[model samples]
Target: MMRTLFDAELNKLNVDLTKMGHLVEVSIENMIDAFKHQDKTLAKEIMDNDRLINDMERAIESRSFNLILRQQPIASDLRNVTSALKIVTDLERIGDQAADIAEIILNFEGEHAYRTVEHIPTMAKKAKMMVHEAIDAFIKKDLSTAQMVIKMDDEIDSLFQEVKQEVTEILKENSERIDYCIDFLMIAKYLERVGDHAVNICEWLEFNQTGTMNDHRLI
Candidate 1:
């Protein structure tokens, strides 16, 4: 029956999307190390592996399109396909943000990290964990866990604000150190954005079940 075929295709899409999410999580992990050590080798590796994320995006996109076209899926099924497309966009953007951080890492000449870098690694780790949990929620279709990840984004944003406040003080005390401090701010911002993307993943996951929430507090 058509229903059986649709369900089979749907399961396969979850598998592919989960695989893509795992790669994005690892890329973010490597980026954290790349920033922490200011390792050009690690930074270069992040850049090199970006194409793999690109390829994964393409693969998931193809699968999503096939499902939509062949299944003529509507209601929750349509939402799933649409959600997969949105998830890919978020994942690709996460990859881009990670690469951008890596490019900045290369400029440090593998020097000691910028003054506020102690927090960047911590923030990256938190954001990466949120992404991991969000992906797990998607795989399990666990709305409660997805909601928890959404709540955690609040903490990540707060941490980002704390880092920014500290960096502002440093820049005021030593204006000459502004260049490196700006890099630190960017790392903080990217991790914050990563948290936001995780929220997006949660948002779409929920949309299929309870319909869309008008409030995007993650914004």
Candidate 2:
């Protein structure tokens, strides 16, 4: 009976994680749309929605802690709960980064600031995919999918470099648009950070599955 209850709670924890992941995925999508259209209203909406993500994080944390205290989970079960705690932290940061990008969009004064860099949207798309896949890997306990998410980080980093080059060229052509270029550069950086958070999530998932991260025992 105790084992059954513990298993049910574990399943509930995963369901909450999936719900939080979906919220983050939608925020990233809305962030991309807001950037493309320079929709201040949508950007503000995304910022407002960040509170929901934060609340989810806190709720997940409490649940994980409750499981640990009540169930005294050991070995793989302990790793599972602990990993959920780490994964939620990364997911919360991803939400914050998305909100940060939205805040940048809200500050844009020119209509074409987003048009100055062509690579940011692609970078955001790839980061979003990584986050989505990482969450899926967690739910399915699929180490291969988690590893693939880690590999995808390289592409996001490469695109970030491309954005920097493109911004530098734009500055060379028109020094007056420095502020716009800088804002776009910051957006690219945030998306790059988002990719990093996704990688963190995957690493924690890997640790959960194999008891090691980067081949070093964590627990």
Candidate 3:
């Protein structure tokens, strides 16, 4: 009976982690849409939803530590619980990055978007995909998928570089638009950081599977 209960708790841990990941994914999608339309209402909605993600992170952390203390999980079970503790932190930060992007959109208000806006949607999509794949890897305990997530970070980084260069040209051509261009650059930087957080999650997945850390930086 005790073993059965422990197994069920492990299942719940996986479910909770997945729920947290999905919330972050939704935030990314909505933030990008809000930026594209310059919709303050949608941006506010994303910002408001960030609190729920934060709440979920705290709850998962509590549950995971409780499981460790009560069950004293051994071997792979202990790793899963420990990984949950690490993974939730990354998910929480990803949520913050999404909120940060939405806040930037809020600042843009009623202004005309610069040409650099064209690069953002694609960058956000790549970052979101990385997050999705990393979470899937965790759920399935699939090392290859986790490695793939790490590899995809490069494309997002490259896109960020392109955005920075384009923003620089825009700034040089039109000094009056400096504020807007800088905000756009910050948005791109946040998206790049989101990809980094996804990479961090994938590294945790590897640790969960292999009992070792990957000392590599994807960014």
lDDT, each prediction: 0.83, 0.90, 0.87
Candidate 3, run of 10 with poorest lDDT: 109-118
Ranking by TM-score: 2, 3, 1
**Clashing pairs in model 1, backbone N/Cα/C closer than 3 A:** none
lDDT tens readout by residue for model 3, 10-102: 889889998998998899889878887888899999999999999999999988988888886778888788889999999999999999988
**TM-score of each prediction:** 0.90, 0.96, 0.93
Error of 1 at 170 (Å): 2.0
Q: Whole-model lDDT for model 3 versus the true structure?
A: 0.87
Give the better candidate number (2 or 3) by TM-score: 2
lDDT of 1 by residue, 5-104 (tens): 9999888988888888888888888987877666789889888877889998999899889988887776778888888898888888888788888988
After aligning candidate 3 to the native by TM-score, how far in Å is the CA of 125 from where it should be?
A: 1.4
* Strongest candidate by TM-score: 2
Query: Whole-model lDDT for model 1 versus the true structure?
Result: 0.83
State which candidate, 1 or 3, has the greater lDDT. Answer: 3
User: How much is 108 displaced in model 1, in angstroms?
Assistant: 1.1
Steric collisions counted per model: 0, 0, 0
